[model samples]
Target: MENIGVRAKELNETIVTLRRELHAHPELEHDLPFTESVVVRELAKLGLDELKPGLGQGHGVIATLRGKKPGKVLALRADMDALPIREETGLSFASTNGNMHACGHDAHIAMLLVAAKLLADAREELAGTVRFIFQPSEETVDGALSMIASGALENPAVDEIVGLHTGNLWEGLTPGQIGWKAGPMMASTSTLTIVFEGKGGHGATPHLTVDPIVIAAETISQLQTLVAREVSPFEPAVVTIGKISGGSAHNVIAGTCELRGMIRAFNQETDAFLKRRIRATAEGVAASMRGRATVMFSGDLAAVVNDKACALKMRDIAANALGEEWVKELALPSSGAEDFAYYLAKAPGAFFYHCSTFESSEGGAECNYPHHNSKFDVNESVLWTGAAAMAAYALHWQDRN
Candidate 1:
């Protein structure tokens, strides 16, 4: 395979162009028509004109680039949704509307689009087919499952899958630096919402009302102990309650209190244990306090477990293409959840992070904002590196398979 990293510098102009356009018109999950059109048009320019759009109900686009020789199918994925955050980056190309590319999906789309362009240009040098997956709703609904359900994983019969995210966790490194782990790289996520129903009465009447506010408080407190006491310390599990709403008036004993949160765990056993405990504690505590409780898991994302062999393959690619310094053994697990977990379950693959090197040392400008935060901004220099790494990986696989 030709050295893709050497050619990445030439595509820097394309990277900036695509990133700016994508960042300007940020779209939300399942509603990325404008962004999808941009991707489709650009992909068509790369000879992937025979496009398959609306794979995941209006947000997923799949395009094929057949190679000269027959080999296993390789799928390259990029998300196309933006967060609801108002862009604070102040860049000229920042999101014009309330939507912002705080999660770096803008970079993901641009990099992958460039990858398609590179692969298409190298079609004669390629050994196998390539599938470009532009996904939507990765932020909230985890649209990967929908794409898989719609047969995006079929036709080509995806032998291996690859994806990337731009985050500042490894702040000082340059764009091509790869962040990955052998197993359990990310925790599985389950959204838990519990509603407490209690009798309402005047605040002055102490015994007349079954105060749900009080029950909610108790339930949350006890729920904390579920992990500290029940689950093993060796296993990583986190239960967080982010939203709570109750009575409107201070003088009235509220009839209902709603609680919303998420449960994250590295293993399925720990996840199941936490769910069972949450249900039992919420219902049991509410019943004892003269209130009823209803609990349900709203949205779920399975844990991202990188296949061992695939992870090693990625490390080798990073070392060769980016250098030894850029490839490091990532031991820490990301507490966040990703829909890519769905893909790994179907086939052997790995989800790697592209270092969005930010100036974290300068306290005046906090560039390393966590995902889902309104102020999150990514270092744009990594755009070309991510594209190069992905394209190189694909080419390597093409040669080997």
Candidate 2:
């Protein structure tokens, strides 16, 4: 087998080019015609065994590379939707459009494209088939479900799958490192909206009006107890009220108040319990305050759980391809959720992290920005490490065990 790390290094310029091109013209969820065209054009050059464009009832691309020998089919995935944020990175190729690839999806697509190229070049000696899944609407957390529903998993029927995420999602991980965990890499996430209805009146007449604002405040304060007191101390959970709105005037009591928040938990049972309690607490508090409350949930996704064996195989593959020092087992799971959990539900696979943080101590920018930040940027110099790891996994997974 060719040294994948060296080959990836040789293709770094191409990787950077593709990444910049995609980054400059970032697109949002559910409407990514431009993004899809870019992906299809690059993939068309591969001359693979099969290519299917426009999946997910929208813009998702699926390409396949068949090898000479028969073995288990592997799926490599990369998401292709940017956030609705304004770009502030100030790169030479920064997005002129309002959207930004703040979560590093541009680099994800570039690495997977280069990985596809590497596997396509060695198809004669490659074992089994490689399915390159360029997914859309991942920011909405429905893209994976959309593709799976539209037959992205059938035909070859992936025996296992693998994907990677980049940027500063964790601490203690330096640039170029690969972070792997055996199970439950991310928490199940859902958003809750609570609407409190009350009577409108002047602020001076506090006794006459049912103040939804007071009820909303009390609910937010009590929701914190769901994680600290209700859940086990060792279990990881988060209940955050990200947004709250009420009242039009400072001296007027509004007729209604709305609170929007996120619920994150690794345990399904715990997640369910928390949601139930959250609804109950909100309604109960509103009733106690002489107001009516309604609760709604959406943008829900399951936890990202990795197959232990698959994760270990990925660790070994990264170690062999990028050197032992580049591979590390993650100590904890992220409360942040992913749509990739949808793919894992259908197949046994692992999601790995490619650390691409920049540090001022290393003469790089002091960028501790988390994902989805407007100023978030990656250490592009070591991006080849991800391409090498994913490509090496497809080549060596069947033979590794």
Give the number of the best model, judged by TM-score. 2
Question: lDDT tens digits, residues 1-401, model 1?
Answer: 46787677588788888889998999998898999889988987877635888779776899988888767888889988998888777777877799988888988999998888888878877777788888998988568987898787888799999998887653345545788778888889999999999999999995999998999999999999988999888888999999999998989999999999999998888898899999999999999998999999967778999888778888888678767877777768788888999998898899988887565454334667777677777777657778888887887865443
lDDT of 2: 0.91
- Looking at model 1, residue 237 earns an lDDT score of 92
**Candidates' TM-scores?**
0.93, 0.95
User: Per-residue CA lDDT of candidate 2, range 1-401, in tens?
Assistant: 56898899899999999999999989988688988998889899999988888789679989999988888899999999999999887889998889999999999999999999999887878899999999999888989998898788878899999999998886688788999999989999999999999999999998999999999999999998888899999888899999999999999999999999899988789889998999999999999989999999998899999999999999998899878999998999888899999999899999999999886775555565778988888888889999999999999999965
The clash count for each model shown is: 0, 0
TM-score of 2: 0.95
Cα lDDT listed for each candidate? 0.84, 0.91
Q: Give the range where candidate 1 is weakest over 10 consecutive residues by summed lDDT.
A: 357-366
